[model samples]
Target: MRRNHTRTPLIEAIERHRSIHPISFHVPGHKNGLLVGDHPFYQGDLTELSGLDDLHDSHEAIREAEKLLGDVYGSLESHFLVNGSTVGNIAAILASCETGNIVFVQRNCHKSVLNGIRLAKAVPVFIETEWDDAGTALGIRLDAVKEAMKAFPQVKACVLTYPTYYGYTYNLKEIIDECHKHEVICIIDEAHGAHFTLGSPFPESAMEYGADMVVHSAHKMLPAMTMGSYLHIGSKRVDAHKVKEYLTMLQSSSPSYPIMASLDYARSYVGTFIKEDLDQTLEGIRELINGIERIHPQLIVQQADDPLKLIMRLEGRTGYALQELLESVGVYPELADPNQVLLILPLVKKGLSFPYTEAIGRINKALENEPMVEVIPMEGISTSRRTTPFSTLALSLEEMDGKVEALISLDDAEGEVSAGMVTPYPPGIPLLVPGERITADVIRRLNEYIVNKANIQGHHRLADHCVYVYR
Candidate 1:
């Protein structure tokens, strides 16, 4: 049977609805941009009306769009996420686990996962992923998950980050099977792997591996607006209705029409042309960077890697220095660590807006005439407990009300309990979560990130080199 790859339900509905020219009275003060005249964004801006469907209700166009979206991901059901994958993670975790239940979570999980545990009033059992020598990335280990479940049979679920920020993944099928054997549902934070469904050369998506639930930041990898994401329930073990209810509670009551429509368009776009697009883009990238002297492209050779991510190091330039060089040539990279500058690509639409040939030239010119420097893995200080304090907790810290106490520095903060999450961005995993004990090692790591100018989020008084701790 031939599939209809050209359909973009929500997008077509918006276009159809806009052509009607109806009189309006709606929640959005813009009211289809009448109040904000001549603004280009107004053309696509819309709200729930007689013809347009509501996001939370989703009986009309939105429902059809979501079905098409789900079909692309091979999910049992898929829901649009206006609040990005953060809310999707929250809703999935909340629906999967019970209050006061124990869950096995990779310590490299996003900060939002900790918040979800708090909201669900569940206890977390941290499972640390082994890191490469430089500690640049954390990879999943099937044995680790098995060992964690073996140690704590009460763990209701296990959460993992597939295709990490640096674009590498594991045998999630094996791990997912291991979780199911112990009656634990596996939830994958597949935010960075949204494009995995594009197929051929891309890693298999977590949804395809029979994960109970998977959250994807569609905007991160697809052509959708930022904050747009998709939540998929891959198995009946996850209650689809409950997940929707939690999404309603967690996401915006007034979701953006442009974001939702763009999601549908992205689903249609990628589903139709990604295989061809990837071939051209990968070849173009190879031509751009493969043969440059004194420069090494840190290509992740793992089968589960996302080839779209281009990480490279110029011999004499630090990641920061290389990043500066790239930007000077009008090529901005995604993020940089001390060792390599990362470029997540196809920044512009093909045959539409990209200066592809010009970009290749710019990149080549930048690497030219640059004197080489020694290439060595720059060791970073990201110390924290291999396992979170929750692993040893006798009770759930959900009801633990902590009073904030300010400290001058973390030098003497050993044994102090954390009042909030303190994490470095790029990979926004928490270093210290609220209600966890702050060890000297964690404190030292925080100081290291601060001195290195890594963006530290959450907690107060960070600009002063001190933070408020909970007692």
Candidate 2:
């Protein structure tokens, strides 16, 4: 029997309850939008009362909604995450690896991956990621994975980021197959790829490639609320019960009803996405691109593997400057790095309209305005792309926990282990992880990033030309 993709069990249940206009005796002080001045959103801000099910121990509406989610993704089990992909990543790692286990990690994974390893007390073998001339960090190559597995035959699990923040994807199927050959659990942080399952123009999902587990930030590409995400058990290789246990422990007991409902709606939105919708979305994106290029012939628009993503850049101008210019004219981009600004185009169904002309007009205005910041000298820096195929932390997270740390200049910090993770915002790939050694190459890259006016995140006083290092 075919499952009805149109059915939103959780939302229907919430609606059924809302239709009753029940009394306000629940834990939420808002009392079903009564005290909140009928803000529309508060109407669905419910708790685990009556028909609304408990997230941690889902047996009613949430269970049915998750079942529908699993059907859509073709996973053994699927879950709604209100805490974002961060918790999903952590829970998946916790469920897969044991203390002191060797885990292979793509070097450019989000800091959350490293945090998961730390919390699990697992050791990570960082596989160096490849980069393009444009400085976009492409995902780990298959050869790198083979090399790491050859070096560490006892690897217990592998965690990878698919379709990087810039929306670049490589041969993920081959990589996942290799991990399976070695009986290593494969987990993918497909935060930017929740729309992949819609097929055709979109890249295939990691779940389709037989990953043991996969996490998605539905809000990234879908119409879900912020912090809404999904975790899928793609294969039986991972302990589904354990994954659920970790999710229960890691997620909030009091989950947001609105976020959960949005997750349900997001899944259904894609689940029912037909050929007409896909064609419509692709056409809109195509028109948007054409308009952007037609108006600003100087802007270099680079489309990634995912059609929904585009990178816009101008020679001699840092992405930071471009980002500011766009924001000043009321046209905001997803994020800006040193080299380019990333735009996540809308994934609209048929009959829906996005203001593409207005957006292009705004872009024209923004680009025509005076430069937001003085163009920093666009000096070429060493790409710092190559490292040993496999590297390890100089000290484990536990070892670094109680150690004394000091702030020092990046130039002088060479040979010291980093006390914190220093990352560029938006892309959020760590320049220096908590226990990684500070090399001269790392210092050079840091200096270039600072000079380019990139927004550096995590622990660092880059404005003062210093970073925290373990004493």
Candidate 3:
């Protein structure tokens, strides 16, 4: 099939809609951006009109586009999402599990998954992951999920974040099979993995496997307008009708036509040119990694199952420090933590080579001239701790317990129950959740927060400040 690189059907559709000069009887007051002057998107802003189909009730144009998307992804059904992947995650959770059902979730999933649990009112059984020697956390191991299912036999579903924000991927096929054996539905948060299905050399997407439901943030990697995403239902195991109901409830009544159009355009873009672009990008990434390896032998650039996510580590400086240096050199990574910085490479913009080469050169020069120092993994005092959910934690604060105390200094927090979830944002996984008793180990870890000067949220009191607590 000969593909037209410049002609985009979605873009053409929007243009065609504008040509009709439809009257303003719809919800959007912009009236095709007539009220908002001189905006690039003015012409594309549209409401449902003749020929242009409605998002929620798709019978014409929207349905055709969605069917095309399904064909491209090889899924049972693909629903266009204008709201971010958060909506898709919530819909998937709501559709798969009943209210008050128990769900096993990876400890390090995004805040959206947590929100989904709350929205569904499902009880979450957290499955802990194995920590590396350096105390860096990875994906949930298959054995851990199996053990969790064994312990919580009634768990209705299991949620996993593939290729975590840190770029760690687990064996999805094995995990999905394990979940299926226990009659637990498998739902995946592939927000960071939107580009995985472009036939890139990266690991296969969750949808590519047998995941019952998969949520993707197309804007993360694809050339979709921001907030453009999709909710994919793989097979009959997932209740597609229930999913549709939840999606309608969660989504905006008046959807953005421009965003929807962009999603359609992005799907076509990947189908047409992604393979070539991905190959070129992978080669560039290889060259970039090799250059860094030659210059700084002591530095470690972590490789992932994903080719798009680039993680680099420096010896003398923390990942946060290195991130700042990279930003100073006009090279910004997607996200950074104490140990690593993640870069999201878009296949759409693969040909730009000088920026990457120059950034590598700067990093090499900095490593060579800078004084070498031993890279020490941050450590802290250990304290006795226990884990509890946000609901239980909140309830516990109201109930008097002599063992629990109000906020105290990190140095003095030993022998105290943690009143909140101490976690780093961007990747908002709770390190020490509320209702957990603080021990010497917890206090020691709390004190070592110099890296990134990371701010901890999800708590009322921190560092000698006490908000309300039980007894």
TM-score of 1: 0.90
lDDT, candidate 1, 1-471, per-residue tens: 324658987888888987887556766777777888937687667788766799999899899889888888888899999999999999999998888788888777898888887788888887766666445565767877777777788889888888888777788899899889888888999999888887767789898888999999989988889999999999888888999899999888889999998899888877777555666766665655544432434322121267777676664445667777778889887876655677776523355445556776676677665655566644444343364322543223744563545565666667777666788787688878777777776776677667657777887567887766655
TM-score of 2: 0.95
What overall lDDT goes with each candidate model? 0.76, 0.89, 0.72
- Highest TM-score model number: 2
TM-scores of the models, in the order given: 0.90, 0.95, 0.85
Per-residue accuracy of model 2 over 409-440 as CA lDDT, tens digit each: 88799999999799877677788999899988
Span of ten consecutive residues with least summed lDDT in model 1: 295-304
Count of residue pairs whose backbone atoms collide, per candidate: 0, 0, 14
Candidate 2 Cα misplacement greater than 4 A, ranges: 369-382, 451-454
Model 2 is weakest, by summed lDDT over 10 consecutive residues, at 373-382
Task: List candidate 3 segments past 4 Å from native.
Answer: 1-10, 21-27, 134-136, 295-298, 348-355, 361-369, 377-423, 432-451, 455-471
In what order do the candidates fall by lDDT, top score first? 2, 1, 3
Q: Which regions of candidate 1 are displaced past 4 Å?
A: 291-304, 315-318, 347-353, 364-371, 374-377, 380-399, 402-404, 439-441
